[model samples]
Target: MRRLLAGLISLFCFTSSTYAAEVSVALAANFSAPMQKIAAAFEQDTGHKAVLSTGATGKFYAQIRHGAPFQLLLAADQTTPERLEREGLAVAGTRFTYAIGQLVLWSTEPGLVDAEGAVLRSERFTRIALADPKLAPYGAAALETLDKLGLRQQLQSKFVQGENIAQTYQFVASGNAPLGFVALSQVFADGRIREGSAWIVPAELHSPLLQDAVILKAGADNPAALALADYLRGEKARSIMQSYGYGF
Candidate 1:
């Protein structure tokens, strides 16, 4: 009886392993938290694993152009995916908007940033952190907001640029900068800003941040890649995104 049970268990494990595969994905830094959670859930539900690499969309674009083995891309803006598709680096008709991101004016120090975002006008802080606008959608949005407020020229001198939004958040969190702009998803948790003070930058201040996802040509024949792409559009993934303050 013991031998029979052992045999059955081994067979089950073999079958599961035979059907499982890994999908390599390049993800936007701002979506790291939710995507991690979603990847775990996706693996649990589908028996496939997601191998994630997070960074600025522009960097990922450059890497993809250089033949990076990443099978999928979750970008910070629709333009990158669209451009990839146009360049024939990704599969056509597979691109879709996965989320709409929001920007925040954040400070690790409580009450340092007001709800109206009037802190940008103050000269109290010596340095302000933001991602490089050329590489990050969040950074571009930050510039647009500053421009609309007519503070771009005045505040440009205090800028401390990060390579990506994740690093930009780190700069402020580590006290390198007293305050700066970041993605709402970074500081958001439990239906509110997790710590410190933040003003959710109104969407009207800049162009809409439509984050898109696509399957790269390298993944065109990969079943795991297709599964992951479809899984991202499913209910479980949508719920995870919503928890992170992402919009559909």
Candidate 2:
């Protein structure tokens, strides 16, 4: 009789309190698609709301540095979280690599980006798009990759910069540019390429992109915040990231 009573009480408490716990997360744009899927899965399994906000990691870092009321941060580069930890902006020892992103040269037009390394040499197209290196890690990689291939000098005049990765992808997706560099996750899915053609730039061309996440200091004591940090590294979350083409 006592066991039955305890079980009934536990159920009532869970049902009554679930609506009150909500976790607020600041997410990087490159991981937005996968994060959405993780949030949905988390809520379904835990009954804790995952409120995700997406933007460029660099911009988001600025916001958090300026004391934004965010509880969690998922950065596109590991350095951001390391700085946050050292500066006391985020909880120490909570940082870890959440994903490693791949940079791709993509074009909305079919065959616009030839994988044979001929497009850079052809000089037929006048415009190329990339995220601003100052605000995006992938953008920095893009620039470096071009330089490695000895095309930066030749391509400088035709470069179009986007403020963030999403905007960079949009520049090509919207037909604003013939080709562009963007996160592979944005252009590929389900073990196959998307509508457009792309070349997944090898990691040797640029620095490794090690995305990381940390809990903000202001959120250290909040249960929701703690849960969110934990959730990002969980098995279910990792699986979603893989679907978006991000690796550990």
Instruction: Write model 2 residue lDDT over 122-157, tens digit each, in one string.
Output: 866889999988889989999999999998998999
Write one digit per residue (lDDT tens) for candidate 1, span 85-160: 9999999999999899999999989999999998888878999999999999999999999999999999999999
Q: lDDT values of the candidates? A: 0.95, 0.86
Candidate 2 global Cα RMSD: 3.3
- Stretches of model 1 off by over 4 angstroms after superposition: 1-10
How many clashes does the backbone of model 2 have? 0
20 Cα displacement, candidate 2 (Å): 5.2
lDDT of 1 at 208: 96
